[model samples]
Target: MAAVTSKVSLKLMIDTESRRVVYAEAGKDFVDFLFYIVALPVGTFIPLLNQEMVGSLGNIYDSFANLSTTYLRPNVNKDSLLSPKAYYCGATGLPLHVPNVESSRKVYRCCRNVTLDRNETCSCGATMNQESKYTVLPSANNPYSSEGDFVKGKVIYMVMDDLAVKPLSTVSIIALLNKFNVKEIGDLEEKVVDLGRDEVVKLLKASLLTKTILTDVFLSVLKEEVNCQQEVEGNF
Candidate 1:
């Protein structure tokens, strides 16, 4: 099932829709958005506004993810891989942990049939996947369309240090994970990439929508330099 992101996470989206005025992360309209406020009222109108709000929120999310890439590096296979094992609460059944694999800063040498890009493909067709270092168990392999070389009672361990060697961004890998139905386990999650406040301010200032969203605070807003529909309309 595809996960539906709550429009609650989107403050900027609410403003662009012009349905409710969002002065900060909280206002009378945004009160219930916190998910933990004791006295907040859940409005009858919020879900009704969801469709338009969703489309706009996606815009902010996408632009943030794209803008983030220039500042971050892709996780990779090699010395950059983590040394300690990363664990999951319940992978196939029991608690699981990827064994301590070798950590190297060296990128994986594509000496075989696998190209640089091909090595990145997971079984699910995601090219940005981490490698499973563990042996797949026979029973687990049996349930799926098998390569027919099934090992039993084990889980495939992903190379961990792949996350550490790169400048982790809040957006890219998480987006990829969502697309591929991948889950994070252990303390090594890419949850908080922590864009320095300066970085966040810089992005909010540079982003075109952000300029529109925060125009009052930023008097001298520079426009985003991009090819847009406005160009095609101008031609007409």
Candidate 2:
């Protein structure tokens, strides 16, 4: 599959005084990417981040990676565990890309319609090696099958700093502002940021590690840039 070069734009409402992102106003693309994270396999987490996770999960993954295949059953494929396929088919055009298992996986069947092993013999003695074509039927309950990811398209979503997601509304905005106790409107700045692959990866990692997902992932980088600009101005 080709790389996803597209970037999604997120309009973040940042509190200047607090130096934190209150929430992000986003579209289906951004929301879809966030939702897709939930479907990722447990084995992919440490490898995807290229760092230690919060607990002993990282150590366990490392041990599995280094373990010899000699001890395992002859039919076992190690790659199946280390880099398992993600079976979700709803998310499309995601900036945070993972290969769709449904599309890439090749299925073979015998007359009995068994799909487990390609070369295994069926009860009728027929070899299950004949490649079969299959179609993924869209769920009857899926309303946005025409053009949408996990959620419906053409709807603006509000993603909180803690990764909470909801449909955008005037009432929601007002409630958020009141919750944050924003006395001055000037302190709340709306900034549109482009999220590409790298930013998405940071988001994925931050989502797992912290409750202040947006602040921890984006705010620290923003502060560093500001600090660098100040230093440059001082030198001039």
Candidate 3:
């Protein structure tokens, strides 16, 4: 997995009256990160949220964490469930930077061409653990050949508050505006927000628990800033 050091910028269209994010205008990098969310394992969500997931899955994960190794099979590793790797065809370059979650690597094979574990003996009895590097060869059928993960690069996308994604277009924007009953363009505000690891993590959590994902993840922060300013004014 490539280290994503740079932050992705999202141009959010917020409804001031509703205190909600109507949609976000995002590029390939942000879209790629959104698409990558589905590829994550069920177990990974717990660690990503620091065990604060809003369901019984957290309890199950905690139970497993406290389980004794002596009662389990020798082949079973706790880390396997706690930090299962997600396989992606191409580099996602997500800024989330999940600690143990990583993209899948090439499968290890024995010299006899039998499927075998790395450093373990095969049925054929040859201990040749040949490591083959996996590469996505570009072809006419390959959609990922150009750039980006899941979606093609160089195009902007529209991301709804509920995490629904689509290519940005005038029609789509108008449709969303109509759906939200947005009569006045003056009520809509455009804000460019920088999404780093912390913000992305909050988004991940919000996506799981709330339908108004963008509003829950971002608007609350804006409300806090407003409240702080009001408090300072009151102090005067």
In each prediction, how many residue pairs overlap at the backbone (N, C-alpha, C within less than 3 A)? 11, 0, 0
| Predictions: Cα RMSD each | 22.2, 4.2, 4.3
Candidate 1 Cα lDDT to native: 0.27
Better of 2 and 3 by lDDT: 3
lDDT of 2 by residue, 79-103 (tens): 6677665544333435456442332
Model 1's C-alpha root-mean-square deviation from the true structure amounts to: 22.2
- Tens-digit lDDT track for model 3 on 85-136? 5544544445445444444435577654633134444556555468866566
The order of the candidates by lDDT, greatest first, is: 3, 2, 1
Query: For residues 104-205, could you state the per-residue lDDT of candidate 1 as single tens digits?
Result: 212222223222222453333445323323333346423321122212322221211111112224454464345434453121222111122232233223
- TM-score versus the correct structure, for each prediction: 0.16, 0.79, 0.77
The top-ranked prediction according to TM-score is: 2
* Candidate 2: segments with Cα more than 4 A from true spot: 87-95, 98-131, 140-148, 184-186, 228-236
